[model samples]
Target: MKGKEILSAIKKDIDEHVGEKVLLKANSGRRKVMVREGILEKTYPNIFVIRVEGNDRTSRTISYSYSDILTQTVQLVFKNNNVAI
Candidate 1:
């Protein structure tokens, strides 16, 4: 999927699920998105594993590139799952 599409899908999933978790398999070099002040927390074309805990609490988001991914499965448990990424 394209970059915006991937990000949007992941964001929407997080919003709908509340305190649930989701994973996004994205292209490498995607982690430049979450960079901090002169520091890099992650590197990409990776799978972004995200967990939503509620009320602005720090969610754990890590990305792994496509090449690095061994296996992938996407499950939409609560409907509204047609959104692409």
Candidate 2:
């Protein structure tokens, strides 16, 4: 697939999983990685959001563009099935 096609495919996959539990792994630079468990929230035309809760009972939303997934800068996996999207 071409770049636009691939991005669209990624967006479609995420759209199907909205409101589901997902595990997010992201590269935070300097050899550090950030991992979080969150519910897949909303998908805009350019980005998708995830709601992550902290140990202190706090929650925040993080959004990433579809290109991040295409470039492997971000990864998403379904919590229940352990399948990467």
Top lDDT hit? 2
Global lDDT of each model? 0.36, 0.93
After superposing candidate 1 on the true structure, give the runs of residues whose Cα lies further than 4 Å from its correct spot.
20-85
For candidate 1, the TM-score is 0.24
lDDT of 1: 0.36
Over 1-85, each residue of candidate 2 has an lDDT whose tens digit, in order, gives 5888889999998898888999999999999999999999899999999999999999999999999998899999998778897
Residue-by-residue lDDT tens digits, candidate 1, 1-85: 6756665555444345533323343333534322111111332334334443334665544434332322223322332443332
TM-score for each predicted model, relative to the true structure: 0.24, 0.94
| Residue pairs that clash (backbone atoms under 3 angstroms), model 1 | 27-45, 28-44, 28-45, 29-44, 29-45, 45-65, 46-64, 46-65, 47-64
Model 1 residue 33 lDDT score: 26
How displaced is residue 36 in candidate 1, in Å? 23
